[model samples]
Target: MTDGEIPVICSGKGCRAPARWRLVWNNPRIHTPDREKVWTACDEHREPLAHHLAVRSFLRRVEALD
Candidate 1:
C-alpha cells in the first residue's frame, strides 16, 4: 500500500468499501494519546466513525487515504 492508501476495507460494521480516509486514534486509558494508528473508512462511514471516536475523545485526526 502507498503511504496514504487504505490497506483494508472500511472498518465500519456491516459495510464494505475501499477506504477513503485514515482516522488516527488511540484510547488514553489503554494507550498514550500520542500512540495512534490509521483506520480506514469509506466516505459514507467517515462521519459515524469520527463521531464515535470523538465522543470518547479518542480521535487524533482524519485524513484522506487516497
Candidate 2:
C-alpha cells in the first residue's frame, strides 16, 4: 500500500486504530524463516502488540508504514 494509506487494524484484542507499524514475522517452528511478511499496528496499540509478539518470540522486525 502507499504511504499514509490506512493499514489493517491491529490484530490485538479490541484495538481499532489504523496501523502505523508493519511488523514482519515468521514462526520458525511452523514455517521456514524465509517465509516472512508484515502485520500492522496503530500508534496507540503498537507497543502492546509488539510486546505480545515479542513474548511469543514471533516478531522479526518492525518498521513505520509512513
Candidate 3:
C-alpha cells in the first residue's frame, strides 16, 4: 500500500477481503433510470453480492476490477 492508493474492499457485509470485481447497480425507485451505483466484491463474495442485488433488480453488470 502507498499514499493515495486506496485499497479495493469487498462490499459484502462484515467482510474485509480485497475486491476483485465491480458490481454495477442502481435502485431505480430511488435513482434516475440512468444513474449507476457501484459495489466492489472479492472473489469469494462476488456471486453472493451480485445475486443479492440481482434479485432486487438493482444489479446491472459485473466487471473485473480496474
Candidate 4:
C-alpha cells in the first residue's frame, strides 16, 4: 500500500480500474431531495457512468479527484 493509494475502484460493472472521479447524485423517487448517492469512476468509465445517471436525472455533480 502507498500513501495515495485508494482502496476503492471504479463503479463501472466488471471494471477494476482505480477511481478518478466521484459521481454525485440523488434518486428523488427513493431518496430525499438532499440525500446524495455516490459512484466512483475511472477516466474511461466516467462518461458512460455519468450519462447513465444523468439521463435518469439523478446526476448532481462530477468531481474530479487528484
Candidate 5:
C-alpha cells in the first residue's frame, strides 16, 4: 500500500488484503518430504485457507508473518 513495501497479498481468491500469516504446506504425493509450499493470508482468510489445505493433509504449519 506504499512505496518500497512489497505487498504480501492474501492467497484467498479475490482478496487483496495484506498478509499477516504464512501457511506452509506440501502435497507428499507429488512433492518430496523436504519440499514446502507457502500461502500468504490475512487474518480474515487465514482460517479458511488453512482449512482448505489442512483437509487435504497438505498443511505443515501456520506461522505469523514477520
Candidate 6:
C-alpha cells in the first residue's frame, strides 16, 4: 500500500484485478482445526470466489483487504 509496493491481486483465474477482499479458508482434510489459508479477491470476483469455497465448506471468513 505504499509507493513502489505491488498491489495484492485477485485469485480468480486469469483475472488481473487488484484485491479488495480477503477470503480465509483451509481444507480440514489436510489442515489442523486452527490452520488458515487465504485468497484475495477484487470486488468483481468476490462473490463467485466465495461461492466456490462455500460449496466445499472451505470458507472460514471474508474480510476487507487491509
Which predicted model would earn the best TM-score? Answer: 6
Name the candidate, 2 or 3, with the larger lDDT value: 3
Model 1 misplaced stretches (Cα beyond 4 Å): 1-7
Single out the weakest 10-residue window by summed lDDT for candidate 5.
1-10
| Residue 12's lDDT in candidate 4 | 99
- Best-to-worst order by TM-score is 6, 5, 3, 4, 1, 2
Clashes of 4: 0
Per-residue CA lDDT of candidate 4, range 1-66, in tens? 479966779999999998999999999999999899999999999999999999999999999866
lDDT of predicted model 2: 0.80
Enumerate residue pairs that collide in model 3: none
Q: Give all candidates' CA lDDT scores.
A: 0.86, 0.80, 0.94, 0.94, 0.96, 0.96
Error of 4 at 47 (Å): 0.2
- Model 4 worst lDDT run, 10 consecutive residues: 1-10
- The global Cα lDDT (0 to 1) of model 6 is 0.96
User: Residue 20 CA error for candidate 3 (Å)?
Assistant: 0.5
Scored against the true structure, residue 28 in model 5 reaches a CA lDDT of 98
Clashes of each: 0, 0, 0, 0, 0, 0
Q: In terms of TM-score, how similar is model 3 to the real structure?
A: 0.90
lDDT of 2 by residue, 1-66 (tens): 789965578766788777778888887889787898677888877787788779999999989876
Error of model 3, residue 41, in angstroms:
0.1
Residue-by-residue lDDT tens digits, candidate 6, 1-66: 899999998999998999999999999999999999999999999999999999999999999987
TM-score per candidate, chains pooled: 0.81, 0.74, 0.90, 0.88, 0.93, 0.95
Task: State in Å the error of residue 45, model 3.
Answer: 0.5
Q: On a 0 to 1 TM-score scale, where does candidate 4 land against the true structure? A: 0.88
Better of 2 and 6 by lDDT: 6
Off by over 4 Å in 3: 1-4
Cα TM-score of candidate 5: 0.93
